[model samples]
Target: MLNHYPLWKYIILILVLLLGCLYAIPNLYGEDPAIQVTGTHGRMINEALLIQIKNALTHEAVQSKSIIWQSGEILVRFMNNELQLKAREIIQKVVGQNYIVALNLVPATPHWLSYFAAKPMKLGLDLRGGVHFLIEVDTDLMMDKIQKQNIETLHTYFNKKNMPYVAINTNDQNRIILRFRDESTCKIAYQSLSSYSPDIVIHKNAYNCLTVDISTDKVYKVREDAVKQNIHILRNRVTQLGLADTLVKRQGDNFIIVELPGIQDTARAKEILSATAMLEFRLVHLQSNIYNSIPNDFDIKETPEGQAVILDRKAILTGNHITNSVANMDEYNQPQVNISLDNIGGNIMATFTKSHIGKVIATLLIEYRDSGKKDARGHSLLEKHEEIINIASIQSPFSNSFRVSGINNIKEARQLSLLLRSGALTAPIRITEERIIGPSMAVQNIKKGLDACIWGLVSSIVFMVLRYKIFGLIATCALLANLVLIVSIMSILPGVTLTMPGIAGIVLTLVVAVDANILINERIKEELRNGRFAQQAIYVGYKEAFSSILDANITTLIKVVILYTVGSGSIQGFAITTAIGIATSMFTSMVGTRAMINLIYGRKRIDRLSI
Candidate 1:
């Protein structure tokens, strides 16, 4: 029976979904074609060309800028293969200099045009492709921070014990091995350090010399954690940049493959992809008031503590406490930022605001430019010359939802809204690998993938029809339903990049589901031949099929679990579709078959159970 829901409610839901799709469809375009004007190492490796290119593209004045572009691919393979440079000499000369690479004029067609055309994404070497990368996440900086945190314990202890130790400036903060101006002072510093040290095990060797060693395993774990964190942030960052349905997946020990549809805005892609998006909420302390006067660049507000002055930099709250953010307006209607927080964040903001009412708090804002202009020296003047509107008063006392205002116009408002929706990574995310496929490559992949899918489906149908006959048609119906569900899911969901691996996963699941129907049909036939009636055979066939289906699906589910747990990006896609397919398939073949049988023969007197 079709349970009818209220028409109004269903219509509202559909409208919401449709509106969301229309709003987000633009992001599918990916980054624009970056106009190429200069190469660092070639005759093109000079400011003159860059300036000329900028002028030709946008008659506006160019400014100093650092626009990072990506090939949408790793600069080198895990084996350290040097990235192919259009002009190596130009690249070397241009790094940290006033020049930017032009991707539009690059001889190759970019990777994203076909992607926008809704082409299937290509796999990296790790997936359907061949090559793979394994990067060793850098942890020197983190280790150094830990070392400093540990050393500070010694400082606190020494202050009480009157021990003098000299500080040394080393890049690694992990080893805060201070040199005691005198050996006697070392003993006092060591003694003081132990008092506050967490699990400090001081040991003396035969020479009676001190050995200060940290938990190497613990430090290693921290680095590993940092790498994982970095990976997640990188994923978020790439997504935020709207990389045209990009796939940033984990491969092996410490590797990720960023696959694009075609060649991409490699330069800007690199800048956005390579960096981490670290966001912190600093309290604003106003010295130069903004109430009577326009806001200043920087200032400080006196807090009750008097020592810790809040930074005047615009900051209502950090991203951590954000429950849900949407683009909306405020009470006064001056385009204010309206932010609703969770219980914890709400409590904090409420208390802070209540205590400091009628005061100023500017949320610290950082906007990374999608693209920028270059000056005579050929530097990205994105931050210097680019315009950014500061939003405030959005933070409020609610755990439900909120929106930020102060968008001077619709354009700025739209960008900010996208940032919140996609989420700003805790750290800057960079695209280590970027490639924009040309139209030719995209068309080829589309044809190849489509052919494979057609052949697979045809083969499945032939087998099903030949073996089960009438039952095969039923299974085919379920299969079609499965396909519809999968496509519908892909359309409704964001961050779903249809790739070759994803297709393979779907194919694999479809095969498994077909097998379920076949098994049930064969069981029913065996029972009927044993002299059971049609309805009785159907009931028994379904009952017995349950155990086998459970056993099979459970094992397959285990593999999917491992795939999701261990696999990175593309593998994740496989795991997701596979799991969803398994779940939905079971329903169609089992529950759906029962419904069909009931509908077909509610109280029939059918004899032979033949197709």
Candidate 2:
């Protein structure tokens, strides 16, 4: 019976302890994998060399490769011998090709021993320590999109009614005013605009001249939609980046927030956020009016350097043609580009080059920083500037495509290709707000968290053993088993991270597991004193404890899950650890303690078990 036990309780205790031992074996005593490296010693690394090293070390051939920079060494960790050997091969490839020096095989320790020896997992920023950023989204681009949609609708209204326009000008702020040479034509254009601008209330002075104001409420709704869409696209881009445990969600009215832990570079974070995934292809229109190559009356645009600048009538070759692109060298030794086009973009390029073989079609490649730029002439050329690219050679089957020249370096070319592949965003994304956490803060927080957990766990264990004596010892055993299961899950499954709150949850769960055992032991003692036999008392105690166990654990489980679902950043640590602890506690308290009770009742000829 659970209320009283003799020698057999020791056997059940040994078996429970063995289960804990079983879980710990794989993590601690497992063999370390050795990978060989031929060249390159410990130091003297450059950016290009670092890229090659990282690529090699992170290659798929290695299993469970972990890269860490600490104590002036690049640490690599792996599990499989074969994968580690592959890492060696990768190291050989880089070291042999690039540098010459004696090699040292770096040593690595398994992360499981750090509270996760029973269950090992990688450390997150909240544990391992690094910067955490909460970046706010910008909604200016959304406003621009709404204005374009409105402008198009108004343009269609004029074109449909056969109204002639000298020109139409719209501002980035979404205001529209119709301009015409003749007063009568202007009046007619206004009539056409009036039909489409039903929500636009006209504010005119006593004169016939007019001003059309759009509904502010309608514009706000449109801006909200655009912001939501931009958020969606940014989410996709972040997903493509493949960061683990990254958090992204809409913040409210005008912004969304992205939380990236373990990301340290403040400038790099800004660059990633501002990167415009825009792709465009435009038909080159050389400013030939100055040199007599113009068609009819097209005027040439001049630059501040006293040279004629070309323009794109419209994009003819867009980034969509690029199926794949890489920054590699060409035959002539110039930093040129090679593009593999998709069917649509390829067909467009092929058709254009085939039609204009010898003629120099001036296509421009424009460099933008954060957003569109202004030209030296003070014109807003950010949205429309291009570097002039002339087609020199064409290559294709019948479909036809040409290679152009003008890239300066590998980094620039790669950036251009990636931007093109991502495509021009429908609009710009301004950084409305930014928050960055320094590494020193992250490390200090983790240390404080660990201190709290150590004290909480040690105190709980001492209390349990002191209060219930031998039964408390059994509860402690069950708690140990629970800890083992949780750690094994963390180490093997890889979804777990030992964040700060994760330690707190472990401590909290340890107390809960102890509570469950105490309830069962108290019930066993009550039944034995009420004249029930030892075996019957043990059975009834376990049976009565079942419902309470389920109810308490389930309620806590629900709360933990809710925290995981909505809470951001390390709040997720609380969720995962709480959930795992609840699950393991239920098993250790009800099932595990009962099994020990059964073993005791079967062996002893007593009327009571240990309390």
Candidate 3:
């Protein structure tokens, strides 16, 4: 009875190991180098498209493992990475611009195991081929834009206060220059605007002008906000694109690091990540004369056909308030964008449309792009481009839901919908550095890491068996079980990316496991030397060594927690696996070894132990 376990204890142990082995089996099946082809806009993958792809690959003399159409997408698995790359190029040329071809990795898990939701653990960009981008945010331009907005705010404020001014504009030096009618008016306006906020520096200048500039503190705050907001929006876009195991994090004050672990197409990732596009709804000034000067609070926008139209500068709704958007066809089979707004946006639209039911409303697309040229100050120049995407007369008062026509094709509609749904970036971002890891390079990294882990585990097992005899054998079994449990947990958990450093964690965990068993084995030997029988020594060894094991593992877990909280990218990946492995090692070293020891020695009386 000294080392005996209850029936339920054995049953629980057996169940846990069974489940661990069951889930761990998926990793052995490995993955396939595959290409995923999905239709763009409203294009749908059909039987005809599948046949077209098959013929293209055949003509290119590229051998494929299988080409199947599933879930409205075409998946072609190849025997190797070279063939997969070849097929992708051929298929892209065949499908034209209507479809998007992307490189992917699909699990070769059996159907029965997949039904149970078992999957292999995800590999990081180092172990898996993917793309990494170092993006820099244009915080200077963002500050400039903010200053222009402040100019508008000042215009409204002065109009309300009945203050007369010739013009309120931003100078080349990025200072707000407010020109007044006379010297007396300039002095009065400066006195009134200087006390507006502590964040602005307002002073009088020559020629009856007043200059306003943002304080240093305000500039820093705006830059911080711009970086944080861009990170959040980039995450939303990656999610909308349906990428898994991706990382988006801030590197410095104005840099963002994005790692797409399973995406190899840099063009698509860059296009989605760097796009600063938004939609604005403005009323078209149909009564204005094109030859005359533009009205106050109005601007001119050109359509695709080179026709200019006057539009209100003030927007009734922007894409920031859009809750959802979908690309679909109208009753006439024409492509259109269906949009939904939040409660506040819906209320604003309801109020605006009720009073002007017959007025023409225009959907304006505003984009800020890099001009590929820098100013004298070494800041990149940004070009603001506006286009009138849609023009329609409001037939009735509508709230929450509406549709926009005048889209050129389904592709345009889909792109607009994706941008609106994912929200807009607060500032422009440019990819400063880009690196692509091909599948072959990933395979090499995987081989090296796997070799390190395998060698470490084998060395640990051999050392334990040589020193402690049968007790060492029991520890070896527990160590193997610990490995299986670690793999199973990583597979089942979401967002666990295995990197090279993560594999190191696994090797370190095995050493910790061996150390734990050695402690117990030495404790048993000491107990036996103190005139104790085999059963009593075994029982006392486990009971006394538990506190030491728990203490050591607790300290390790504390360090792992700190690493995870403060680290990013590959450091976080390392922390994640180490934490999981530490936990699993504790379980296997204590409970698992004890259970096995009980089965072999707890059945009958023994005078001496195998050790």
Candidate 4:
């Protein structure tokens, strides 16, 4: 009974292996060239849309393997890349600009395996051919925007507190100036504002004004938060495009690196990633006098129909309050936008509409665009544009749900809706650098990596079998199990992308695993040579060799953890795959091999064993 395992242990081991094999089945199905379509606004990917897509494809005589909707996007799988390319152009025209149609490669997983949510390991940007964008956040512009918001907040706070002040404004030097009647009032205002806004530096000037500037620490904090928030928003936007494996992380203090895998449309990715779509609903004011001056609390804008309109500066509702929006047609067959608001936004709209029935309300779309120049400190120059997309009069009061008509066409309506659904960015982002990976290069890299893995595995197997004989064959079996378990774990786990470096890690893992088996085999042979019984040698060899195996694997695991924590993109992928492989090898070498050894040699006592 020296190396014997219980019946339950055998059952558990078998179950684990079976589960791993089951999960690994998806990887065998391969992938198909596909086109993904995502509606910009709130276009639903339901059966009706599927029928329309099918009809359009049939009309164009584009043959496809299957069409399925998943995660708010429609995927049309084709037999070959040629058909995929042809279908993309035809579908884009059929769907119009309201939807984003992009080229992709989707897993052709079987229905039985897919029912368990088993998916193949995602390929990284380098492996799947995608776009890489180095986006720089305009920290200077963020600081300015924060300062202006603070100035406005101060104005509101003073008005509410009945504090006497002549004017509150922001200067070119990023200082908020509060003009007061006298020094006594300025001193009081400084004390109050300083307490209210602790992050800002409040100073009483000689001109009876209080100058407020953000502290250095606060500025740095704001920039850091902006970059982090932009990363989160970019991830959400990318997911909305139906992309699976995307990398969005901070590259430096102000730059982000976005790796979108299997996305061939660089222009579309750039547009979606860099868009800052902010919406506002304001009361419109019509003026007859050409030279009429507008108040400080209002702005002048032009509608899409070439009509000039004046709107309030403060919005009754903004995109932040929008819960949902979709593009559809009105009763007269004209395109319109249907919007759903949150509770607070609903209340505000209801109150406004109740009081201002028959009054025109303007829907303003604010977007930020790069100015094609860098500023003095090497930050990108950005310009903000506010356009009135819709000007409609309220016929009745409503809450939560409402519709805006007068959209020029269905395409525009869809684009507006998509922007609303994607949400707005807190700050502007500009692509400082971009790179496209072609499909041919990706395929070649994958082939080379596969070749390396195959050769490494074969070499390991042949050496083990030739040297250790039967025991070597047992070790090889365990190694194969380790590989299967590693891939299965990665496939089952969400967000694990396999890259070329990751493949290298797998090869390295196989080398380490083989070394472990060799160590154990040599230890057993040494024990047998010392005149020990076969059972005793097997027990002693495994018990003693475990210490060395644990030490080696633990140290390597520590290094892998460091790499994972400090590295980015492909480096992280390598770390992840290596870590998982190390863990699986530990299980297979000690548990898996020991189980097989027990079944083979633990049944009866033996004086001599094959070495």
Candidate 5:
């Protein structure tokens, strides 16, 4: 009666263990070497594309287990690494630049377990072998853009306020210069501008020219904002790639570090991450003197179809105004991109189209690519290219939504839609450093870590069984249950990545679990030696040992929490595994072992017990 548990307690224990077993089944299925094919530049991936990929694989004599289309990507699983490698090369040559072919590992989970959304925990970069890139943000271009915007803003404010100034222009040193008629007007303008723009400093010079300079603090803040914006945009774009366990974070003031676990396509990853797919809508100048020297407020650009066109300097609408975009077919069955704009952009489009019903409007696609040079500061030179992706005459007034036609193919339409959906990069970024972790290294790491865990577990089990006899064996069984519960919990939890440090945490957890069992067994022995009955000793031993075990686990949990709070990457992975282990160990050691002991020894009284 002293150590007996209710029937409901046994039911709950059975349910928990069964659920744990269910979730842990996927981990045993392991992973297969595979290659993923994704559309680039807005190419759509569907079931139809699978045939093409399969054909390419077959042409190269690459044996594949299966080919499946999932989440807008094609996954081709290979029977061996050699076939996977051969298939990658053949597929790249066959598909060309329209599709991005990357090497990856696909889960070989059974259909039954996958139906429940049970997946093996994702491995970290070190364990899974992936690509790591250190990208540098071009702060110079960001500052230049900011300065130009400020100059335009000041000019607009002066015009709206009816200030008396001869000319308003930006100097070579990036200062806004306002040339006034007299010192009185200059002084008044300086005071008004200073009061209005606290982020800048205004000074009047000898020639009555007022100079507005951005404050040092404001400049630093602009740089920081630019870096933060780039990081956010990069993350959004990378998410479109459907990568799991990917990490994108700031490494320093102007550098971002991206880790793509299980990603092997360094070239494609670099291209996607560095692409600045900014869009601009401009009106084509139809004046008769178009061949003459262009006005200062206009630019000359080439259309995608190879025709040169003159466009207004100011864009009527930009990528920032785009709210939604999708790839679709026009009435003629030609591929096109349908775009929806925000309210302000909608109003602007409606007004412009209403005034110039027959004028041609151009959608400019601006991209930045590495220029293969480095300045004095060691930053890569980036060149900007602007081309008109679409040019169409306005037949009627419309707002909010419009379609861009004349796309060469469906792949181009898909690429445009993806770029519009992902939004534009705030600034150009270049990869300064890139490192690829091969699959062989990852396999070696996995083998070594698993071996270490197996040995640690075996040693813990042997010690537990040798020390306390039957009770020790019961503890060992509970320890095994703890491991199952930990793995199950990790498998079910979203975004949890397992790493080498996580393996160490699991090994450490086994030691702590065995220690807890030892404490309870020792307490039971003490109670038995003091002449207590077997059932009473079991109850008393558990009751006294609970406090010591709780206190110890809580202390370690506090440390793990701190570690998780301050750490990043693999350190956090370690903390997560340890924290989960501590929790599951407490449940199994206290409740699991107690339940087993109650069923075996609680119902009967004995003067002598094995301890």
Candidate 6:
């Protein structure tokens, strides 16, 4: 009974090992170089388009390994990267502008394993090799916009409070200038504004002019928030676009670093990642004559169909207040996007609609695009684009939620919904640096790392077998199980990316496991030398070794936790693998080896131990 295990224990161990093997099976199939074709602008992938793509590839004498239509997209696999590249050009020309053809490395997992949602661990950018971008946030523009908004807010506040001010505007230095009739009025206004918020600094000059500026700490906070918001929005955009294994992180005060593993469409990635698109709700100036010179407060804008309309420059609400949006069909079968706003936006919209019943409100879609030109400072210039997407008369006083109709198609509506739901970027961004890692280089790195792990494992197994004989063989089996369990757990967990440093962690973990086995083997030899029976020595050896094994692995886990907490990128990857390895190694080296020893030696009387 000293070395024996219960039936339930054996059953649990068997079940765990079986599940590990089941999940670990997917990694053996590896990946295939492939091309993914997804529709854009509401274009759906139909069988006809699929056939067109196939025919285009065939006409060019590019043989594809397999082509399948799945999840509203077409996946074309190739035996090598050469065919994949050739097929991409052909597919792009065939699909035209309505579709996006992107190079990808898709999993070659079998259908059986996929049915259970078993997948291999995700590879990092260094191993899978896709695209990396360093983007700079336009903090200058963000500050300017914030200042303008603050100026408008102050103007509204002064008007509502009946303050005596001659003019309120921003000057060339980006400071809000408020002119009062006298120095006394300026002092009074300054006190009122200062009491409203501690974030602003107000100065009164001798000429009855007051300078309103943001505090230094507030300015720093605003810039930091803009960069952080952009990082969140970029992550949402990439995820919605179905780019797997994507990473978006802040690099510095005004920069973000994005890594897209297994995605090769740099242009598409750039277009989505840097887009600063938003919607605005503005009142149309129906009384203004479009044929004449427009008023200074109003601007002439156009619809997508080229119809001109006059609109107020100031917006009642912007997309920043939008909390949720969804695309749906109206009673007339027209495409529309239903939008929800936050509390402040809801109150503002309610007040505006209640007074301006029957007035025409327009939904304006604004986008900032690269103008194909650089500024004097060598930065790409952005051209602002505005179009009136929808216009409708107020049917009632609605707040919080509303729908915008007049969309061109379902695709456009869905796209608009996606952008709104993902939240708008606080500032524009430009890609300052870009690097692409080809599939060949990624494969080379993966092969080298894998080779190192495999060789390390084999060497450990040989040493254990030669030193401890049959008991060493038992330890080798546990080691193999530990490896399988680690792979299976990594596969099951989400967002675990395997990197070279992660492989190093796995190697170190194997060494730790071997050390544990050596400790147990040496203890058993000591017990045998003291004239103990084989089975009793085995029991005593394992009993005394558990505490040491637990202590050592717990210490390792403490370091892994610290590394994970303070690290980023590759260091975090290493910590993840080490943590997982420490856990599995503890189990296999002690509980697992004990279970096997119990089955082989627990039931029989022996004169001497093999170890």
**TM-score winner, 3 or 5:** 3
Sort the predicted structures by lDDT, highest score first: 6, 3, 5, 4, 2, 1
Query: What TM-score goes with each of the models?
Result: 0.50, 0.64, 0.87, 0.77, 0.86, 0.88
Q: How does each model score on lDDT? A: 0.52, 0.58, 0.85, 0.84, 0.84, 0.86
User: How would you encode candidate 5's per-residue C-alpha lDDT over 426-498 as one tens digit per residue?
Assistant: 7777788999987889989999998997888888778777888889889989999999999999998988899
Candidates in order: C-alpha RMSD to true structure: 13.3, 10.2, 4.0, 5.8, 3.8, 3.5
State the local distance difference test value for candidate 4: 0.84
Q: Candidate 1: what lDDT?
A: 0.52
lDDT of 3 by residue, 157-272 (tens): 99999999998888878999999999998888888887898888998889999889999999999899889988888888787777888889999789999988777787656655
Pairs in clash, predicted candidate 5: 41-415, 42-414, 42-415
Model 1 Cα lDDT, one tens digit per residue, 297-356:
544333212333435454556655664445545566544344556788777777676666
**Clashes per candidate (backbone, < 3 Å):** 91, 32, 0, 3, 3, 1
Error of 1 at 192 (Å): 3.2
Report residue 136 deviation for candidate 1 (angstroms).
6.2
Off by over 4 Å in 5: 45-53, 69-72, 153-196, 203-211, 284-313, 323-347, 358-362, 387-418, 605-607
Worst 10 residues of 5 by lDDT: 40-49
Off by over 4 Å in 1: 1-137, 144-183, 194-196, 199-218, 228-263, 278-446, 460-486, 489-501, 509-572, 575-611
Best by lDDT: 6
Give the CA lDDT, 0 to 100, for residue 512 in model 4: 87
Model 6 residue runs over 4 Å out of place are 153-172, 176-198, 202-211, 283-312, 329-335, 354-362, 370-380, 387-396, 406-411
Give me the runs in candidate 3 sitting further than 4 Å from their true place: 40-43, 156-164, 197-199, 282-315, 323-344, 355-395, 400-418
Q: On a 0 to 1 TM-score scale, where does candidate 1 land against the true structure?
A: 0.50
Q: Which digits, one per residue and each the tens of the lDDT, describe model 4 over residues 556-580?
A: 9999999999987889999999999
